[model samples]
Target: MTTEEIRAEARGQAEAHLRALVGSDSAVLRDDQWSAIEALAVDSRRALVVQRTGWGKSAVYFVATLLLRSRGAGPTVIVSPLLALMRNQIAAAERAGIRAVTINSTNIEQWQPINDAINAGEVDVLLVSPERLNNPGFRDEVMPRLAATCGLLVVDEAHCISDWGHDFRPDYRRIRTLLADLPPGIPVLATTATANARVTADVAEQLVSATGEQEVLVLRGSLDRESLRLGVVRLRTAEMRLAWLADHLAEQPGSGIVYCLTVAATQEVAAFLRDRGHEVAAYSGQTDPTERAALESALVEGRVKALVATSALGMGFDASLGFVINLGAPQSPVAYYQQVGRAGRGTDDATVVLLPQLEDRDIWAYFASLAFPPEQLVRQTLEVLAQAPGSMSTVALETYVELSRNRLETLLKVLDVDGAVRRVKGGWVATGEPWSYDADRYARVAQARQREQDAMLDYLDTDRCRMRFLRDQLDDPDATDCGRCDNCGGLTLSSSVTEAAVDEAGAALSRPGVAIEPRKMWPTALANLGLDLKGKIGDGPVEGRAIARLTDLGHGQALRALFRADAVDGPVPPPLASALLTVMKDWAGDWTDRPVAIVGVESASRPQLVGDLATGLSRVMQIPVVGRFAIVDASVAPGQGAANSAQRVAAIHRRFRLEADVPAGPVLLVDDLVVSGWTLTVAGVALREAGATAVLPLTLGTQT
Candidate 1:
């Protein structure tokens, strides 16, 4: 047979397989989708498919898997990003008679059996998280075998592999290494619904192998989603936003999503909507895995009105969702487009709304601050690993460095990519690869992020069609105004909120007293840092209270203003002071012992605020203001780089001296903010040793 005749036969088989998978006899593959399958199955070439969501990207893989497996090739390996995505893929694969198995954080016990099944050819496809690729045991033990035998490799959500992508993940960078290690001539496919030209180019260039510069079949498609009717609802305040959602959420055509910018907002909005008689639930990274699965299922089955969520719900969750409403804007237009694509996937028309707020920029800035740590800290971490001979767990390394757990994890992934460190079962070990900080690359990535933010702002304020602005931001070559958007046709979405609803929302947010759990143990690394502390803290402070998190919905705005970088540090304002009284009342139930004196932790930045808070607490509770703890040497005080427990404890210890005599009763410790909680732990230990019966730590706000 001629080459074209063979290709035609393969295409026929693939379409038959696809039709069977979707359970519809009329189902047919689009031409571009068929091209992707042909490239992967017959041509055996690397491919990158940049198509909009619900465009049969999954079909390309499932059909290719069927063709490849029929040729007696090994099972396909899919690097998926989210558990929700994995769950959806597994179900879809089963429908196609393809046996799909996953090894993720939620199912560790099944790893051994799954590994055995893969080895025995019982599983047709294996789905693993990007983080799993770099895990110590998986990387060392199973990855080599899988890389050698896997018939095809699929990277779902390939945009994450690019540093310039809207949601760049460090772990995803390890895919380049995996690609380089794959056996020769194995077809590789990467797919994403959200990559622009820049991101698409970045990701495509990274699809390399031992063969060197493999030709990637770049399949680009138009990104316009015709079913979505996009609009924006601008609100003057957070309360009004919540009220509008409560009043109008049920009016959406079907069960949908309501996106929030933070976990605190998720909780607050979910509660408020529930109070207004909507069946809703809060979904974020904080939700348990079982609960998240149930929530996803509920949304799919139309059992709930919406899942009030953060970006945790973003990635590859598959449903015929009918609408999406953003309570606050995402920082990037590309990200906004990806999220709104979730709606109108299965219907002719679905609503997509963005309620923009000035506060959203602050939230965006807080997240942006979590970008790659400075070069000094990176070098310091590398030096620590180099000096140590055996593998050191991240916990052990925390003794010598100051980065937080999440930040440290991110940094370690980068170092792993640079060959500066190796993660093992015991922990991480120095690779002795002589790595240098890529300052220019990091700077370029930062600049790219700023541009994305500016584009998002432009999207909010544009006089043109919202859909067109989004498409242009994504470098969609066929971008044009969609007559469906509010800007194009002037739909009647009101900014006005009912007074009764606004008042109820205000009351809900005003409810005070977010719990402040006490630190039960000192950082285990403290002993390694020459501190005499180890194990559980014997005299740790009792469970305390914070008026609110700086990220909370109601009191958060005021606290954030007070803590702004340029805001003048002064005494606690009248509004925050009044809120504290309510917090005190709410916390009264938890206090077993009432008689106490107040003690303030001296602050170099906010001396007046800390001092005034202590004094006010003393007056309101009728307890005496004992005294303040003064820094013996403010010059040596810990810097912001000391974000971990051990570093924070080491930096702040012995710097503060107790100025007042210890009272015989319980002591209330006051501070402006609580982050690592180490400062409070050390101060409480000192107060206890100084003969105080109990120490209760209180703060105006707690960093989440």
Candidate 2:
């Protein structure tokens, strides 16, 4: 049948399915969902699902599967990133009287059901995790048989496979290759609630085949979540922040999800909120799937009015939520979107509030550190694929190694097309995957290629227009500004922030080539380093370079001269001069080493908090007032260029009238934020024994 005719028959079947659902009183779905079915008909084969986290993205495909059930197109294979998500989808499908089964690492034996269904042409759908989907059995044995007989290949959390996606999973990298293994001419329907334009393109490129124009189609929806109101707040202490959250719920009431960065924090916040007389529930990775299921049921049915959670909930079930609050700062826009979108499940109005502490930067940096392993991963895979025997296809490579921790996943894919290797029958056997090589010469070539990608990542880390940086790397260099990013909102960035006017521009090698001190870099740098920019030089590696040599030709007039001569990833700042300033100021002994607590961020009726703190230090200790200070995220980020973070923090220290409370060693403390009186208390206790004049703390956020 033609694609459209097939789509029509499928829709008719789906309507019957939904009608059966309504008769059984299974769900309270709206008419818009039916409209979605028609829309699917018009755009039959390829699909794009744009909905909130709880909008039943899975339902759309499940309905499609049932619609096409009569055709006897064998069983549909659903690929989900997480094991839990696959199970959830399977469970929900089972509830609707649909025949569904799942298999992951935990139950590899259950995969026989999938093979049985494909052979009998009876199973409607088989849900499996991406990891399990590529297992030796499914890949070499099960998949080839189900190829043309398969009905549909539903890819869940499709964004995760996109390298630019926030929750990029290493396993998801094999998605494109897996798609190639699907049933011939079977419709490919992909769904993700978190993909941006950049990620969308990545998805298409990876899935694009040697077919006509419709190889992979794109569908987009407005991200302007009208029911959600967005707000940002910066704070210092957990006690005050929890209390504030409690008050917020008291006023906003109903049901909400409070997302915290850690399991312990989620537990603590849940307890703290409960003690304050708020109905609260907490979910973490530690919670078993059954307990998680119960909790999800509670929130959906409104038994629990609030839930404090870590990022553990699977992405399959549906819910109508009221509010989504960020209890701690999120690491990236993608993560923020997923959490915030958990609210506003299409049936209700939802609000999103963000509570950020400067320390959260350190927390995010900690997560970024995980990507470090991908470096060794790429080189090793290339080497392995280069030598072996047959075709070096991703599936072949996957069979040899349990997992690919490879760094350049995209490049490995590119090599597959460039005739670097051929696709052999059983799996990939390498044909040298050869390159110009005199062993050492090839090594140099490999290093150069690595540098090229490194330069791109550096651009992501150290360039302005993070969105543009990513777009450029993806080959859509001319794409317009993505309106949702922090950059589009006009936040000045350290990446592109030039010295207002550089009179003495090209003067390099002036300052000592010291490693940048990375403590608390100004928000400008941290925000700048956020994922959109690619190339990033950690403060640690930014030690005095062997010497700035022109890659093309050596000498130039301004710093731009160095930039223009030969393209390099980074080197935008001087070392942290503030540490020296701090040392110099401390040696004078007028400043307190201990910090005073700051209750208010802006001014208050009572001038109790440290206000003239910077002026006081400058006048008393005679320190330079460089006026280059900016807000700094106090959280320590070991994943960052330590030197970069430290230098920026030092620069921040010099400029602003920060709320500082230092200890009383020989000097008074100067702190910018005081969430509670604890920092002050600690500083005061330290200062009193040391015999310093005082301890003070400073901050700039929610006053009352």
Candidate 1 lDDT, 1-704, residue by residue in tens? 99999999999999999998999999999999999999999988999999999898999999999999999989999999999999999999999999999999989999999998998899999999999999988887888888999999999999999988988888999888888878888899999999988899899889955666567889989899999988988888878988999888878989899999999889988989999999999999999999999999999999999999999998899999889999888989999999998898889889999998778889889888999989998988988898997888888898787788889989998889878898888789998899888889999999999988998988888889888898888888998888988988835577778999999989988887787787887777677867888888899788888888888888888888998869898889998888888988877777778847888899988888998999888888999988776788777754542577777777777577777777887898888887777777778888888878988888999877
Give candidate 2 regions above 4 Å deviation. Answer: 1-13, 21-44, 51-56, 113-118, 250-252, 274-281, 372-704
User: Whose TM-score is greatest here?
Assistant: 1
Please provide TM-scores, in order, for all candidate models, with all chains considered together: 0.98, 0.54
Every model: Cα RMSD to truth: 1.5, 17.3
What are the lDDT scores of the predictions, listed in order? 0.88, 0.50
lDDT of 2 by residue, 233-349 (tens): 444444345556755675553677888877756765676667657788889878776787788878887888877887776355456687777766565555666676677765445
In model 1, which runs have C-alpha deviations exceeding 4 angstroms? 638-642
